[model samples]
Target: MPDNFNFEAAPFDTLSEYERNLLRSALSVGYYVPGETLIEPGSTTLALYIVLKGVVEERGKDDQLFAHYGPDDLFDVRGLFAGQTRHAYRAVEESIVYELNAKMFHELCERNAPFASYFQASLAAKRQLARRDGQNLAEFILTRIAREHLLPAVEVSADLSLGEAARTQLEVGADALLVRLEGGFEGLGIVTRTDLMAAHFQRRLSDDTPVGTLAHQPLAVVELGDFLFDAMILMTRQRIERVVVRQGSQPVGLLHLTQVLSLFSTHSHVLALRIARAETLDELQRAAETLDTLIATLEGNGIRLRFIMQLVSALNEQLLARVFEQSVPAAFRSRCCLVVMGSEGRGEQLLKTDQDNALIHADDISSEDALTWMAHFNEALKGFGYPQCPGGVMASNALWCKSVSEWRHELQTAAQEGRPEQLLRLSILMDAYPVAGNEHWFSSIQAQLSTWSDQGERWLSDMALAALQFDTPLTLFGGLKTSGERLDIKRGGLFPIVHGARILALRKGLMVRGTLARLQVLGKHGVLDQHMADNLAETFELFVQLRLSQQLAGDRSGLRQGLDVSRLSRAERDLLRFSLHVVKKFKQTLGRQFHLDTR
Candidate 1:
């Protein structure tokens, strides 16, 4: 075996070390020049070929190029197992390959079930494995957390005096102490430096008072296996410095926010804290400027796309809510609801895009006042880095910013008319989430929309069919089909999964806002089989992650909505193509489920 061989390559990487060593010993290197044929149609299979360098092209029966394989790519596994070639494999460039003869290949397969499964698995199975493999990548934050040395929890008796608790905290050199509950309470409580300082300044209790009185119950807790990102969310949401770590309900240690911050330290927590503390638009803008830097840092650290989206969504909402509050008077704030539509509302947005927002004013508020406030709110958002929507789907537009009764009437009218464009608009509105003001107003409108959507099959079918607007970009031979230089991955892949999930959720009366959450709900309620739901969820995540990577790299250009496949590694391209195959299957399912052809 070569010293520089990359064992991390797919298919080969999936093999156990023993299997790899056995295969490696039997491998023989072969070379092919550009335009040289390695395998021809109807030719008997001789060996399993793994590309060590350069590219190979696979052509269909008509001699049309269908797929390209590069370094560390494997081919002819299916043919070698079946004893014949289905497609011609020709070198696209000068190439070096390692060959394992038929006898050795068969022996390896017979000895290793997992290695055999890697070559025999279906496209959906490959996608699942790819997703699982991504989770195991070295840069993932969870992988790092698993290797960390956690600190033990510093515990103190609830009956101890404040002075005694302080002395114990100093003695242990801990920032916070857990108070063991007795008598009335059954679980433990927590007391931090903030609590101690507040108590001492308020003069509300003497130092002789029991420390238990200072400790707060119902503490935030995380399991030992929880991802660091999840732990960060818990701390951010609860506004706490530390959380109790448990291993199956038994207290194990304390996870301090400062320790987490030191690990990554890209200033995300500081930015989030600043957003919470901002009192003016300028202050919010200062925090908003850090968003791009924060996003780049998180992506670089290999944080899961879903977690990154959630964090950015949370921060975006905070920025918008603060601007809304500062612009709209307190009196008017309660009378109206500020809602975000589309990706922002779904908590799946990764970067700042055009604003897709609306306002739902109370019935008592006059149209003039509502519009006046909303126009200011829109301009504020634009100034804060959110561009105005091209289609005018924003609060500044009087049509979108309306009273609850007005919205109710508008939806009813749209449903009755059943126009495709109106239905599309309504479909976008279906994803609305309240970011500020009276959420009850938005919920009231959502309930009415849900009732209408549940009763109308025609409407649901129309919405689901929109997902088929773009083809899945895969050829019949399961190879990618690209236009000139680019592929619109969002339209070709992401939209189908998202819209299909949305339609299913509506049919089942599932009110979940995000695509993955809706799929889980549908699966839980038996609307979709577990396997199908899991495949869709994993595929959707891959699409999001790929698109986000392109966006982060500033690769967005005219007519290019996804990554350029020619630039990706052999492994990445393989994963992407397999994911698209899953999308194709999902779209077919949606077509049958909705009777799209007849419609």
Candidate 2:
């Protein structure tokens, strides 16, 4: 038995002697020291390193110290099968580490079901972190107790003023600079040339303003040791043009938009432009398909799933807007509104889920021709890859293709006295995003929805409660039960979290599409407490990661690419269980938050 003891004993401790013997035969010495590079980021590291003594500090080249590894913590196991190169492993002090390569590690786990069981939560947690688009590398590492490459970044204070920052940018010719704290980029911020220009155009700040004053809080960051591919995805997803690269929390270098893009498509900007200018239906379809290819390429290159979804959604929005411009008649077009509902609304359109949409035209007399033209445009989307929604919520459905007066009336009526079935079916409509047409129509809808009264809340609460009713697949043993077979990860696991969040957010009068986003809005307003919100959001992100992973798998296998209920790991089951608990709390919270319990 090892002398080092875990405060929370892992399942490994429960293995039978024979199982331990099977595991022990291939075991390398359990070892590690502090302040050493245990597994450098970017190398192919396929092994489990057991720490025998000394704490290993997980430091990114950016100088960000994330997690501290203690005895018995498993390191690099994800890398063993992740197919991605090792990331961020320079120890903080002298340490000894036992490295078990893939084959031996597999045998040991195969020999001990308990040891393999221990892996479920670890894998689920890592994959969830990986799929979160904008979480800093430090945040990512802290959770793993495991993994940076330093990137180029500039150090600036958060107290700096926009104008002062602008002067520094002009002098240095830097498009952006990173705000820094003594420990690292934790408090670091980025100031871009555009930010400077915007500062110049907008009034109300002095020249002597501190350079740090203009720093946007939590300026997104990249560690020096991170893969360029990861950095590129973050830049795109967060819509930032540059990232501060740091070494061990020190701003060592700066990575620009150009450098980040080099790792993505040959030129996303060029493709975006081409998509914007494409005129005909055939050209738009081709552009949309090209977007799929771009996403597939990005996915293949190990770009994070959240980032892929962001780019695909952005590309789609641009393409559809162009199509709207081309198809809608010019005169009435200015008064109409086109929107995307459902997953696209949440910015979570992984692998082309069906289109959930509706259109709003002007209140005044409209031509049947215009409606007909709109119907034709909806058909065009099918060729472009958005399947006609099975529920018939698209603009082509006469019930949904209404004038502004009709839409406002419908929403008000729904709020005042809509049927539960209607609310359930039309929840997506409430989250509609205006891709094109009348901006005013969107604003009107948004305002009315936000001001929804007690009656509205009741409808929303019931809808939310209904949505939250999905039983989390967690068993009484806190385990996920499958048919002793692979489970449909989506049905059993993800949809519960997502749909629950959706109903609650709506009940709270929130319009944000992403669950993470909805939680942010709701949490701020006291609808969800901080811990519950964080857990709910994390659970949803976990669901997205798993569901998307399966979709990618099915894509590779040439399957239909719908949600798969099976094929989850044990760790994922744990996460899903955690998520269900989160939902239970949410359901309880929803009852309280909306006065359902009191009622």
Candidate 3:
């Protein structure tokens, strides 16, 4: 075996010393020129092919490109046991592959459970391996604050002169200095270069001027045990560039925003800062446009999709809140609450989709003024690249933007009528997450959803039926069914999970918005078996990730629901099949639970 071969990747990483030796003893290298066929379709897969050099193209029927493999990429493992290759492998360039003997590979699989499981595992197990495969960034994102290069605390006495503090900062090359206060101060104070510059401009920094006087107390601090990501969020939210790192009450070091940015190789903090500092519609719009860039950077860094969604959601909510604060009058703003519905409301939305928002104002407010403000807000979002919701789910719609009493009455009417349109609106509103203003009004409305579910089995059945409306995109023999070489991932995978989880949570009267959170709560309370809940959660994540990858690959106009099957790798195809099966099983569960057929 060549020492150059990467045993650190995936299934190879799980092999034991004995198993590795067994593999090494039987491994043989093969080379092929460009256009040479390595494995012909319908031929027996003699050995598992691991690409050691150059590119190998895996083509299906009609010579259509399925996927290509390069150095360190392996292929045809699924065919090894099946005894024949379903697709043809042609060398796109001069390629060298380390072929492992099929008989020895079978022996290794029999002896090593972990190694074999990678070739034949459920979506959940495969996902776990994928995470392990991405350990560098996966582990990087979960890195603790203490592990990063935190600046050591440069502390000065309360009586230290501004000139002396400046000297100390220069001597240590520190951006800020911590001041130890006298007279029973609760925490240490902080003074930055900005403060020194301000003091210099004011001519207030005499040699006798005390640094403590300029220092601000009650410093923002994070524990050493907290994740570096959490520290970044703290800095973003607090609008601070640096935070004091404390172990218990003792200040140990300072974590600057730059440190966090350096670690992730992303400007997510800078993006957040831009959004935070934006005071005009045009400024916010510019900031909103760069979100795709930030998301791409994060995704490319191998950060978990869930984390990317969460970070994007936070930035989005902030953008909305900023718009709200700027557009609405102070008096009216205090009287109304702004909410986002659908994907945005659930915090699972990655790239920008159509606007799904509503407004709820105090009944005493001027209706005309409220409507005008909401219309402006909607237009502002449109200007910011959030296309108007085709179904009129935005706050600009008078039906959606209503008073507390009016919304309650409207919901009750929907429940009573049990009409399809009304039920759809109810589901959309059910996902409402308050982004700005007095949230109590939104909560008052949200609290009534459980009671509305009690409008009897008829209402519940109607709501649950939507989950089963779309058929799973699978053939009779369990193969993936595609149209125009693209599958409606939203309809086939995402909708069933989202709607199923939504209906299930509603039935149990749980108020959580995100699909994963709803499943978690459901699982914990015995509504769904823990394992099934976990499977559903993972399946939902897989679908969202797939949809997001598709969205990111193309124009960022809106949700890209169609997944091009030819673009998927063999492993991805397997996972998709498994995930779809999980969806089918979940739909069956929902069917039985809600008695969908009878409806």
Candidate 4:
């Protein structure tokens, strides 16, 4: 075994000292020269090779490259299990590898469950394990309340004097005291030291005043087993300093905002708070630019794409609202509503893509005034790192920003005409989510559109038919099919699922904007089977994660150039294949439901 073999990487990291010794005992170093074949196709498998240095390539017949293996990369586990090589492995350059004896490898697998499962687990499971195996010092979202050090709540009777409660708080070094509610009330209430000070100074309350009058109720609380991230959201939303940690009805302790923030100091909520506090465009721009860095940090800390999206979505909305409030005149802003469309509206945006937003103003508002306000709003966002839509689908476009009646007329006309462009616009508009101003204006227009969709099956079919625009990027025998070695993930995987989900949601008149949420609602209402819905949701999440990985690696082409297939790991490639198959299945289901062929 080489002295520098990375025991901290992958399945090795899951091993115990006994298993490490077994691996070391059975490991032998092997060296290969450039163009030299390490394993010939169809030959009986020998040892498992982990690259120690240089490069190795896995090639199919005619020397077609599938993937490249570098230092710390393990190869041919499938071959070792099956006892035959499906692909030939050759050294791309001078290479050194540590070959573990096959018998010893199997013995280690038999001895260890996690080690064995790493070889046989599904792609999703493999990804999760791989993340867990990485640097986990920043992974705090899964931290349960019981796992962290919490402040003890000094429980006091409601009838206790304020001075005594204040004395007890000081003696116990507690910032807040829990008060048991009187008059047969079952829940607890809370009074902070600030409350005591305010009562003493502002109200000139007597020291003998009952703490019950000072305690705020009903108290905001989180369960003992709740994820700390959710607790943070609760506190942030409620604008509180602390929440009582409870096990069912019994109070356990107090978790403060400061305590949660200490672990999640660089978390998304911090960015949201920054955006919320920014009163100027320059201030907002400075905060918005760091969002990409934040995304990378969160991903590095092993956060899942769905949660990342959720947090980013909320932050982006806050940033947009701030932009609108600052850039638009207060008088004019009251007469209109601002909305984000497409992926942004769906709350599925991971990286900052193009601006797909619009304005819906009151019919009586002057168009000239509204246009001036929206132009500044759009430019403010562009300065804040949101790129303008290449298709001009932003609020600045006259076609998108319009009065209520104008929006209604245009939507009705589009529904009646059903042109390709009109269909595209309609699909985009279906996912519109109000970010600022009069949400009622956006809802009224959206409700009318839904009613229009209900009036005709032909229009709904036309919309659903667009979902099948691209073929799944898969070969007849289940291998990946790519253009110039790149797979357009948005076209092949994301579009089909998103559009299909949208069409179904529209058909049922469900106002939900998210693709996964729509699928859940559809499944719940029997429009889609629960099993299929769950599969599609998982598949969609995998596709989004894949795209985000590419984006994080500086492939900012986003929905344009697609994912570079050659850059994917074996597990990622397998997941991509599986997800594409799900897209195919989902498209077929949509086609059957919409009667596309008859059209």
Which order, best to worst by lDDT?
Answer: 3, 4, 1, 2
Give the alpha-carbon lDDT of every model.
Answer: 0.79, 0.63, 0.83, 0.82
TM-score of 1: 0.81
| Candidate order (TM-score) | 1, 4, 3, 2
Per-prediction TM-score: 0.81, 0.60, 0.74, 0.75
Candidate 1's C-alpha runs over 4 A off are 1-45, 50-73, 80-99, 103-140, 143-191, 202-219, 244-254, 413-417, 475-477, 555-560
- On residues 1-599, what C-alpha lDDT tens digit does candidate 4 reach at each position? 55666776667888999889888888899989999999999998888999889989888988677777776678899998998899999999999999998898889889988888878865555556556622453357777778355788778898999889989998998989988885433557789989999999999999999999887888887889888877876765555678888886677788887888777766666677777788788999999888888888777677877767777777778788888999788877778999998899999887788999999999898788888888999998887677899999998889888999998888778767777788788889989999889798988898886776755457888889889989898865456788898888888898998999988988888888699899999999999888788878888888887778778887653656688888886556756776788788888899899998676
lDDT of 4: 0.82
Please list the residue runs of candidate 4 whose C-alpha ends up more than 4 Å from where it truly belongs after superposition: 1-111, 115-123, 133-139, 147-224, 234-254, 332-334, 405-419, 445-453, 556-560, 597-599
Superposed Cα deviation of residue 327, candidate 2 (Å): 1.6
Clashing pairs in 3: none
Model 3 residue 30 lDDT? 95
Best by TM-score: 1
After the best TM-score superposition of candidate 4, give how far the Cα of residue 321 lies from its true spot, in angstroms: 1.6
Residue pairs in candidate 1 whose N, alpha carbon or C atoms collide under 3 angstroms = none
